[model samples]
Target: MLNALLFDLDGTLTDTDALHLLALQQLLQEEEGRVFSEAEFTTHVSGQANANMCRYLFPERSLVHHEAFAERKEQRFRQLSPQLQPMPGLLRLLDFAQEHGIAVCVVTNAPRANAEHMLRVLGLSQRFACVLVAEELPRAKPDPLPYLSGLECLGARADEALAFEDSVPGLTAAVGAGICTFGLSTSQPPQTLLDAGAHRVIEDFNDPQLWAEIHRRLDVR
Candidate 1:
């Protein structure tokens, strides 16, 4: 049986991707005089660190400058936290999971401070059994370190968990960690997510048919 559910935070549980994009755009523009289209911006930092993103956007900028730019973006993200909205059906799902005695954790590649700030604003800091921050690992998504670390903290095994994510990198990380992966359409198309290794993909969290399928999987495991 699946004993736990691990979730990706930004695009999975909350609607903060737009805010994150805005912050990154502002930082890149002010520091490097460059404008990135939505596709360009997302493709650049899809699953990369701030420093790497900076280098990719402004190769001429010093590492120190890039670091400062990243800090500024984070500061702006903190300011925007109060506006963080939980994804549809999130509360219901969480409540159902808890009632069913399934442990839930937020496992993300976001910095610890950013993660805490967002969760606090969404009143979700205490909802999760564990919050695994990316900084805690030497590597993040697409590497399995974050999810593996989360499983360790939850005292759970791969077969005993299900992972919820919305992006290709997140799905890949969870699948690589040996967990069953469920993809959300909040960030990508259903086909894209499934192509990235999601066992199944849903258009919305509130879909009764999808939840039925998820429950079936959980029950059978």
Candidate 2:
């Protein structure tokens, strides 16, 4: 039985990718005189941890510089948080999960502050049973540690949980931890998520196909 649902906070639950992209674009232009296209952002930044993103974007910068840059970028994102919106049908899905007595958890590679900010803006901070941040774990996405920790916190087994992700790294992390994973085609193409090991893909929670799969997975009467 599917006892719990684990969701990625940014792209999966809310359409924060565009905001993040905008924040990065502004940060790069102001600090490094650099420009990034959406495609470039998808390839280099989306789904990546802050340290990894810093290493990729500023190979010559020290760890301290990277930390400062990341903080500034995240601050920009928070400033743009007023534009954030929950993914279509997300509220309905959350209601369904609650009505069914299914636990909900958020597992993200984002910093705790960013995650909390997003959740608060979306009015979801109180809905989740647990929130797992990659920064708090020894390892983050693509390592399975964050998702594993989320499952453990919820007292859930991988086979009894469903994980929703929007990026290759998040998909890999959830699938690697043995959960049945669904990909949300928000930041990445469905094919990319499939190649990364998603069992299924949907544009958002509103997709009837996603509901069909959820019903089957939970064996709902």
Candidate 3:
């Protein structure tokens, strides 16, 4: 039986990917006069570590500068947190999970402060049983530690848990942890998610019966 769920925070729970991209673009433009398109940003920086993402965008800058840039981006993101909204059916699914004795945890590559801000702004800080942030681990998504730690916190084995993710790195981490994962196509293409090891993919959480289907699927085997 599916006893727990690990979820990616940004695009999966809230539509904050665009805001994050915008913040990065603004920071780059203001600091270095560099313009980063959404496509390029998502392709190279999204789901990557803060330092790695900074290096990819500012290869000429030093590690210290990269950290400074990341800090500014985070500041901008927090400023935009008020605009955050939960994805359709996300809260319903969370409520259903809680009501049915399924543990729900947030396992994301986002920094703890930013994740907390988003959750608080969306009035969902208490919805999850745990919020495992990237800062809590030495490595982030695509490393499997975040997802594994989330399952550990829930006292659930990988085989007994499911993960919901919308990015390749998040999906990869969850799948690599030996947990079944479903990809939501909010940030990237569904095909790319499946290619990244997601067992299933869906466009969004707009369907009313989606939770029923998810429950049924997770309950089997």
Q: Which one wins on TM-score?
A: 2
Model 1 Cα shift for residue 211 (angstroms): 1.7
- Per-candidate Cα lDDT values, in order, are 0.81, 0.91, 0.83
Give the alpha carbon lDDT tens digit for every residue of 1-221 in model 3: 77898888888888778889989888878877988898997798777768778778778979888878788899998986676778887877787787778899999888888888989988998888889987679888888888888989999999888888988888888998999888888888878987999777876566534555565756632
The order of the candidates by TM-score, greatest first, is: 2, 3, 1
Whose TM-score is higher: candidate 2's or candidate 3's? 2
Which pairs of residues collide in model 3? none
Candidate 1 stretches greater than 4 Å from native: 59-62, 218-221
Each model's TM-score? 0.91, 0.97, 0.93
lDDT digits (tens) for residues 60-125 of candidate 1: 979898878778888987876666778888899899888888889998878888888888888888
Q: RMSD in angstroms, all models?
A: 2.2, 1.1, 2.2
The TM-score obtained by model 1 is: 0.91
Predicted structure 3: clash tally = 0
lDDT for 55 in candidate 3 is 78
